[model samples]
Target: MDAPGRARREARIATFVGLASLASAMGIGRFAFTPLFPLMQDSAGITLAQASWIASANYLGYLVGAVASYVAAVKAPLAARWGLVVVAASTLLTAFADTVARWVVLRLVAGAASAFVLIGASAWALALLARSQRLRWSGWVFAGVGVGICLAGLTALVVASVGASARWAWVGLGVLAAAVAALGWRAFATMDAAVRPARPRGLGALDAASWTLILCYGIFGFGYILPATFIPAVARAIVADPRVFAWAWPLFGFAAAVSTIAVSHLARHAKPGAAAGCSFIVMALGVFLPAVGTGLGTLCLSAICVGGSFMVATMACLQQAQRVAGDASGGLIAAMTAAFALGQAVGPLTVTAAAPLREAIARPSAVAAALLLVAGIALLWCEGRTARK
Candidate 1:
């Protein structure tokens, strides 16, 4: 092959590595439990409150890992390698966890590992693709998260049909993650040359508008997590059959993947903040659907709306940070990430508190939708602030 052909081939490999890495880390390590939680509840008689604690533990660990990744000088490939290993180990170990305490610890470890894997693998893959001028392939890399989610949800649907225990489902996911890690292990080798980022020009570029965007990003996290964490459970309440309710998550994941591609086109016509604000409005509608409407149709529509819009908000928020903060965007972006993680941690706890209510999902969904609507309006104001300045 010619030199150019060789670079393109290497870039393609990098894309696959990134996709598989994120699938294992995010889809399995971070979100597999969401799909499997109902099974765990059935098998172990775990209460919704206990599940909330477990989910919050994972989110808290993700916050810690995000901060560590930002401050540390670790090499990309090394972070990617060990992160994936830990994610697989933590997931597999959860199979033997007999108590809520062990579940919390294992999930915490898995969450932190997922964060590191995301940062490291994304950095490594994007760098390689940029070098080869195949950066467009990066979209497929991120879509892996949704693909993995769909895959996990489908796997759970299958496992439930076969009457396999939740432990067996965990074992299956752990093995699958390990398999992908091993397959893509060599692709990260070429990324060893990547270096730590340079010192920033400081937070001088951050203005009121930037801070508002950060807050809005956090709100987006809180709004989406309610559905992302418990949509399966909610669907089950309406439809006891796994074959029927299990499809909710797969639809959510599919919409997530499609939205990623859709957002790029959206950017061509509107500012990132404007586009993201519209996403929040759509997500607010999604969040409210299940609250007011009944049956599988409304629940599934909610899943599609919430899942489809969160990534748009995420991508747009970071892009807006870069635009508004210029050379100082790194720290600003990190702040937004931490804020988002904190919001996610708070979400399930809110659910746990509402678990005692006569109508848990509707009340919380109402509150979440209200918050989202307020934030959506705030983002539009922030967008205009930039224009006025």
Candidate 2:
């Protein structure tokens, strides 16, 4: 084979491995909690209050993981591998843990691992792809998150159908993470991050537009998370059949995966902020839809709209950060990550505080939708400002 052909082949492998890494980390490791909520409730008789606390533990761990990755310098490859291992162990361990406290501890570990794998695998694979000039395949790499979520959702559905325990779901996903991590474990053991460390910058140094961008990202997190956690439950409320309600999460994952790939191809023409703006608007609609319609069709559409747009929103926001901040993009992105985590962390807690949400999902979802809409406008306004400059 010619050198060009060989390089392409190698790029393909890197992309596949990268996809596997993210699938294990983000999809299965980080997000398996959402899909498993109902199963746990069924088998464990877990309450909403307890579930909220447990879910928040993972988000808190995510925040800690992000901070740990930055405070300490670790090789990307090794971090990715160990992160995968921890995710598998935590997930596998969750199956046998007797108390909710134990589950929270395991989830916290999984949460931190999710961040490590995300940072490590992304840094390693994207750098390799850039060198190979196959950066377009990055979309396929990220689609792994959606793929992982889809698999978890489907697994839960299968488990529910067979009258199996939630433990089986966790075990299957844990094994899946282990298998994927082992698949592409060796390639990144030597690869460093894309380059030398970025210059240290802080929030105080960011300009007003950049500040606005960060806040918008946080709001995006706050806005979308409520639905991400509850879409299945909402569906369950609408329908008694496990088969019908269970489709919500898988549909969510499918939309995320497909839309991510589609938007990547559209990157040639669309500005990142502009793309992010559109996604937010669509997501806002999805977030608010079920509130008004009260039907399964509306719920399914909500899944597609929110799921389809979230990754696009993430990709666009990061791209916009890079465009606006340049070398300082690292710091800005970190701040954005923190804000996003905080936003998500606060999302579940709102359930605990809001008396209305228990009686009517409409009020809180409406609030979330409004936030998303406002944030979407903010992103567009910032993009327009940047374009004019």
For lDDT, the strongest prediction is: 2
Which candidate ranks first by TM-score, i.e. highest? 2
Summarize candidate 1's per-residue lDDT along 1-389 as a digit string, tens digits: 99999887888888888888988988888888888888887888878888889988998877776666666645667778888999989989999999999999999999888877876776677667767877556567777788888888988898888888889989989999898778767767644525343233345655777679778878887888888888888887788888887888889888877786666654445787887888899999998887788778888899999888876676567557656765445456656766777888888887745453225767778888999999998888778877798
Ten residues in a row with the worst lDDT in model 2? 191-200
Error (Å) of candidate 2 at residue 83 is: 1.6
RMSD, model 1, all Cα superposed? Answer: 2.8
Pairs that clash in candidate 1? none
Model 2, range 1-389, lDDT digits (tens) per residue?
Answer: 99899778778887888888888887877788888888888899877888888888887777777667655655567768888988888999998987999988989889889877776676667667767888777788888888888998999899988889899999999999888877766766644435323334555778986788779888887888877888887777777677888899999999989988888886746898999999999999988886687778888899899999988887778767767776445556656766787788787887753443323566667888999999998888878987898
Model 2 TM-score is 0.93
**Model 1 ranges with Cα > 4 A deviation:** 1-3, 192-195, 198-210, 265-271, 321-332, 353-358, 384-389
For each candidate, what TM-score against the reference?
A: 0.89, 0.93
